[model samples]
Target: MSHDAAMSVQHPQDIDQGHVVARYVSNERRYLKLLGGGFLRLGEAERAAFIAALRADALQVSPEEIGALLGYEWRSRLTAAWLVGVARRIEWRERVGELLLASELTYAGQGYCFALAQFGGKNDAEILVSYLDRYLPHLECRYDQGLALGALLRLDSRLGTSHAERFAVRDGLWERWVDALPHTRGTADAWADASRSRIDAWCNLWDA
Candidate 1:
């Protein structure tokens, strides 16, 4: 399927019982779908409206629908994670943590990190620390290490923990991540600095 067609896939009614059958592409799922791309391209006013709608829509999604979204392809999974985070659906926290550790898909980890950071609890920090433990040793895997670390630090500040310090020490996991970056970006702290910005952007999405 074309990229556009794939983005607009029909979400079957089987995925969302109780809700009337209709084209998901034309409904609130579109906001969930836009979490993948179109949402970021809007002007500031439109973006604000879009973000509001997404949060509102998230409140209306059933647990069954969230489970189905998480089980779908990357885009839907990303959307589900974002919705879970925005809605502060604490019940799904562990499930999101499991997906983060699994690293099953490409872009979905970004959403998982966002959700965990939004949860802002010790459990979320522990999950990120575990992820770093598993992946930082494998430098070549170059996955969501930066985002995960940044989210950990964000949680650390909020929850009064220092989970990220060991990783940022000289020649440590942070350095390993930086080394894996492209040759043009070789500064020791470049990755760490960039990570903060990325996590901040995700966290600040709903801020005043």
Candidate 2:
């Protein structure tokens, strides 16, 4: 899916009840996508509203709802992961870690990475390491290695750990991964940019 595609706001009545994000109001769903950074065309006022709405909605989302969202398809799972980060739901760390390691769906791992980065603990660091450990070897996979590495690097900065050191060395996994990309930007730039947007979106929710 094109991340830059313009997403229309759905009305509460227009949204299907079976949709993973349908539990949230239409505006919340729209803002959630904004938070996801897949839709970048928003005014400042809408951005502020997205942050506030996400903050309020995260608190209201239940454990069961979150679990179900994670169990659902990529969009729901993505939203669930973002909510986990915004709410700082540490209890869901293991589950999100499992999903991150699984690398089940496209784009969803970005959310998982963001959640782990928000949790920002040794275990989360280990999970990111495990992800890099698993996927970095298979250059053909081309999954979330960049996002995982970026998140791990961010966590290492906060935790003062060298977890990302081996992967990021000269002509190391990081270099290999970047070179393997078909449409990669500068080294680590794509990962750093996307990860920053994801973290900043949820962090702003908390800051609000």
Candidate 3:
């Protein structure tokens, strides 16, 4: 699929099961379908919204059950990875990050690295950085370093707009970011401090 085609997918907001927490406890069939494929095979946006809605209101349920969705099946596996990577729950982060890191699937690794950068601390960031260095591709459509950098900036604002100033996305940022920019690096650092100059130099190319 073209980047535009891949990104056109929207969240199935119409499928809201009213009070996401209550319905899960009631064992609603639609909830399972929402995660699986009821309306029309949950797309990235739909899955992301499902996770966000659940995280926002479904705080009472067992995270393990919610966690199970990640590996329930390969068809929706990316959705599960999205849940693991973006969930605010610490347990989710730890479990998913570790699992994704070891996964033979590199696509999942991108999301895993992003989550680490968002919620991880020093060690987490280091792990994320090392993983990116070892696995992230240098060619276009495969480089997702922007997420790593964005996560670090989210973690530490001191890095400043200097980091995003040159980002090639002049119009905006959205789902297609993974395929929009061509970023490749010879090395990476979890702590912006260790590779301060290099990061700045690399980010400088955002405008180039």
Candidate 4:
């Protein structure tokens, strides 16, 4: 059967059930189908449900599942990135470490790295800083580094001597991010914008 035909054969009720299953299955294609079908249509309740499922002990997906989604060639990188965002919301803090250890540099990894630095606690911040210091030179997506910088700035304003020094360094660090902004996928804009706004607020707080 043609790919579209196979998809059409899935019962509507099965499709909905599949969404619930996909949330727990730890399979990339299943996740792709469910997320692709439901991402745009998800209301706050559905999102909450998805998060709850993700957090359930019975549904604890493996790091390999996340790695596969991050590395999947046919999948939407942005969608995978958004999944990482969801993972962060589900309080999978340790998973970010797995993402950092994954072999490939995926946009999903980039987004997760940013989320780690943003929502992560002190240990997460330290890990992110170490990762950046180690990997920044080799990464092609320097914009992600900029996003990481923005996240770090938000994580601790006092990491630097003063807020001014932090902003100055962050401003310089974000130049690559600013240059790459025009080329990023539209779906990534929300993460990028949130990163920017947080950094901006930090700068403004010190300025005021």
Q: Quick one: best lDDT, which candidate?
A: 1
Model 4: residues >4 Å from true position, as ranges? 1-41, 57-103, 134-143, 157-171, 176-193, 196-208
Which candidate's TM-score is highest? 1
> Candidate 3, residues 1-208: lDDT per residue as tens digits?
1222121222223233223233342233333543312323568786556545644443444455455444433223344443444444456666655544444443444445444543546655555444344433433444334445455454344423333322223322222333344341222223223333433332232223
Q: What is the clash tally of candidate 1? A: 0
Q: Could you list the CA RMSD of all candidates, in the order they appear?
A: 5.5, 6.5, 13.2, 10.9
Q: Comparing 2 and 4 by lDDT, which wins?
A: 2
Task: Return the TM-score for each candidate structure.
Answer: 0.82, 0.79, 0.41, 0.44
Score residue 40 of candidate 4 by CA lDDT: 29
- List the pairs of residues colliding in candidate 2: none
Between prediction 2 and prediction 3, the one with superior TM-score is 2
Q: Cα miss at 10, model 4 (Å)?
A: 30
Ranking by lDDT: 1, 2, 4, 3
Which parts of model 3 are misplaced by more than 4 Å?
1-52, 73-77, 81-87, 103-114, 136-143, 158-208
The lDDT of each candidate is: 0.74, 0.71, 0.41, 0.44
Between prediction 2 and prediction 3, the one with superior lDDT is 2
lDDT of 4 by residue, 1-208 (tens): 1111111122223323323223434443334433323422568776556545533522344444444444333232333444455445435556555455342433444445544544546766675565555444442444245456556656665454222233234333233334445764232344445664654432232122
Ranking by TM-score: 1, 2, 4, 3
